[model samples]
Target: MAFGTVARASKRFQAFDLLATLVVVIRHDGTIVFANSALEDALGTSRRTLEGAALGNFFVDAGTLRTAIDGARTNDFATLRYEAQLRRGTQEPLPVQVTLAQTDRKAELLLEMSPQEQQVRQDREVRLLDQAQANKELIRNLAHEIKNPLGGIRGAAQLLQMEIESRDLIEYTQVIIHEADRLQSLVDRLLAPHRRPHVVGDVNIHEVCERVRSVLLAEFPHDLEVERDFDPSIPEFRGDREQLIQATLNIAHNAAQALAERRAAGDARITFRTRIARQVILNKQWWRLALELHVIDNGPGVPDSIKDRIFYPLVSGREGGTGLGLTLAQTFVQQHHGVIECDSVPGRTDFTILIPLP
Candidate 1:
């Protein structure tokens, strides 16, 4: 009977080893006692190497680990959230999240990591929120200030054209009228998305990519190339179709413009790649499946000065740029519960959009 009981207990222990999340058990004196299989898999290390080593040894900073251990001793479980560099042997340090907990017989630590892509998504969301709010306010004020005077300017130009006897003077009046009409059109474009009704439906991300691809190819027939790498297994998501198209088009347009200079030089390429990232956390919410779409280009990257504030309303690196392209892109994506981010370096630039799966 005792032998059977021991076997059952051992089986349960093995089950825990198999199913447990990444965790490491350590003695009260800070010696590693045991590490679950998940931890081993995550860190690429074995229990033999981890045992008897202080938990702090794995952390880039010794003081942070010590403080967490001290807090755990008093509170039974303590979480310390600071940036740490994780290393195993000669490999480069990896950024990780370290949480320490204390039990009656042993202490345990849990390490989690923030992927580079997800981190960028988060930063982009924050910027988008700020930019959208600012742009909303700006548009409201600008429209009120400009709309009333625009009609008068157009009427005055028409009146001046009728009275002017000289052909050159009439031509100048026509130019004024033309400029006023153009400004009105520009204002309408800026306000059109905001005023239109949102048409929500089930959207296949691949379809959006394909539409953007066709448009981009038609626009830059000889000067550029647009590539696609999609995962067909992903399901359709809930969003506004026209809004998504515009948002995607804005980003793709910027990529095309960036590559224009390179296109003239005979070295230009743009790629659209899509995949599903599992167990992703966005805006402090964990998602089971998030669609990741990457728009990459081979061109001069974003300038360093405006990199951080590229999503801010009216911020642009180009001289004639209105700087509303990315701001509008972010607003539309966020409206559909998505995020857009950019990372750029010399000769390579990547813009990533992540939206939750239905």
Candidate 2:
């Protein structure tokens, strides 16, 4: 019996779908026999559609994958590894690392795809974590340093106002008091994230979405619309209710603000979408399932100038923005051991919060 014939007779392809890495099983002639969910997602299609399709159909530059599969079938190497680009449906081709190996069963060759950008994202995550921790310490000390003297300045200004006979001089003292109060408020926001510890319990993800939706609609009832696309099957998980609310609200509010032009066009929208993710890796740990809450906006995307620094403390993309909203939202989500990521383009921006679910 030929090795290819024996491989075609094997029946364990389903096990490959549970893996986190994108996987595809192919025949000796470059026909795709099976594709795991990860691979299907990469190809932007269903398994049924992917099966029987030519493996080279999805790669713009198929040279590397073609040679790798040939070597895997011929046993040139135990594994053939190379980099290739995967073409998506009407989207940019994705850069990925391809690994090909022969299966124990006959001529069945297994191909694994890992996004090349995953490494870059991981490196960026590490740096962000480090930056976040350092920012926390700086905020704690600076809030105190500014907060302690702020009250004294305000009190002295008030005392000066009381002692001044000239009404014009009294107005100057009032200005001093008002500016001091503004600074005090800013200091309070800087210290906001550290004000409380996690109050964890079973939290219904939908409830959080609804609450934020109501709040946003009440605030922007003119032309803004908050839409919900929820998956009811998503189970309750342990999280801080108030923190989740605040974090989600910050994102939604920012989206609404960005929709100023869209609002004028009478089509501003913010979508609160919840879905379940399986076999996910987050913050360098594996989870069976995770909660994916996406705050999607149909507005001008994040400005390119401050796109990368949007989460940094005191960095605001809008006029009169304190720039503390996203920072606090990130801090709260991090407290729940989740990570938030944003992807933006011209008219769409998605702020996705991933929290591991039990």
Candidate 3:
């Protein structure tokens, strides 16, 4: 193929560059005509290097791709689908589901590669989003139901306390009122997200991080250290500034509390890292660009018992924890069309928030 022809072919397939899945256009002879950006990143090679290379060579078992290509060329199948390990330059081979289809041009074929790990992650994200939506409805309805009787109970207890003459009887009424008030507060928190209107405006993510960092330091000034590694190039986007600040603060505060042992030893540390992820997938949607905000801590990782259910309402790993911090944080981020994920191991815990950017 001439150089001009290859450049035009690549330009025509530029739309594939925005996809998170790796894609390449190959000739009937198995020579790659075009490799998208995602494919380049996965192979740890440049498009210029990938083009004109044999597509079958990138797979662990070259025969598998060769056979698939032959099948496609002969019109033996509408589409060939199989799982294979893909070779890369800088890392271990990645397990990917390969899909091959014929393009309109007789000499060209379209091949897509979806990483198995990424597919699983996308499935999990979908499930998490579904569960979050259901939880929000359940929480809002349940909270309202609890709220109605709670007010009556507190008012009745206050009246009963005033009528009681014996100090012991009065103390019991006071206890009833206190317990009712506590329940009311809990119910209020459960409904808080529903009550607040989503205020949208230009929001600088670094400012949100700075505000949260200030709060974390103020609350744990003695031993905790809050560090920032921000990407100044991240432009402001439309979001609720206060909500983002509160969401970030909640995560940071939770980290600080988890670092109790380390804090006493005067070596507790937390970091706020921000970067731009390209051709990303979040909540099962492909994004050309997204902001990746990570809140990392050096405390003992999340408990094994609650690892999966940490975001569920009323779930907590720490004693005396309200268990609503993460739930609220998730709710706030979701309002901005984003998702929060936690990756934790011994000595390190990272909470990543992904939101699409314009």
**Reference-based TM-score, model 3:** 0.96
Model 1 CA deviation exceeding 4 Å by range: 1-67, 74-83, 88-91, 97-124
For candidate 1, the lDDT comes to 0.74
Residue 315, candidate 3: alpha-carbon lDDT: 93
Q: Give a tens-digit lDDT track for model 1, residues 1-358.
A: 1446435533543543643244566655566656655557557887567756787787667777677677776774555556566665677666655545544443444433443444665665666766677878888689768887998999999998888799999989989899999889768767776788888998988899899999998988988988888888989877898888888899989888988788998778889999997655555455667899899999899999999888776688887988888878887887767778788998999988888775
Top-scoring candidate (TM-score): 3
lDDT of 2 by residue, 1-358 (tens): 3446334533457677677778988888778877887888777798777777788988888777778777776778998778888999889999988888887766678888888887576667777677789889999998999987889999999888888799999889989999998998899888877988778899998999999999998988889988889999999988899999999999999999999999999999999999998777777776779999999999889999998898889999899999999999999988887888999998999999988997
How well is each residue in 49-151 modelled by candidate 3, as lDDT tens digits?
Answer: 8898888889899998888989998999979899999998668999999999999887889999999999988888888899899999999889988988889
Q: Model 1 — which ten-residue stretch has the worst lDDT? A: 108-117
TM-score of each: 0.77, 0.76, 0.96
Please give the CA lDDT of all the candidate structures: 0.74, 0.86, 0.91
**Model 3 Cα displacement at 119 (Å)?**
1.4
Worst 10 residues of 3 by lDDT: 279-288
Ranking by TM-score: 3, 1, 2
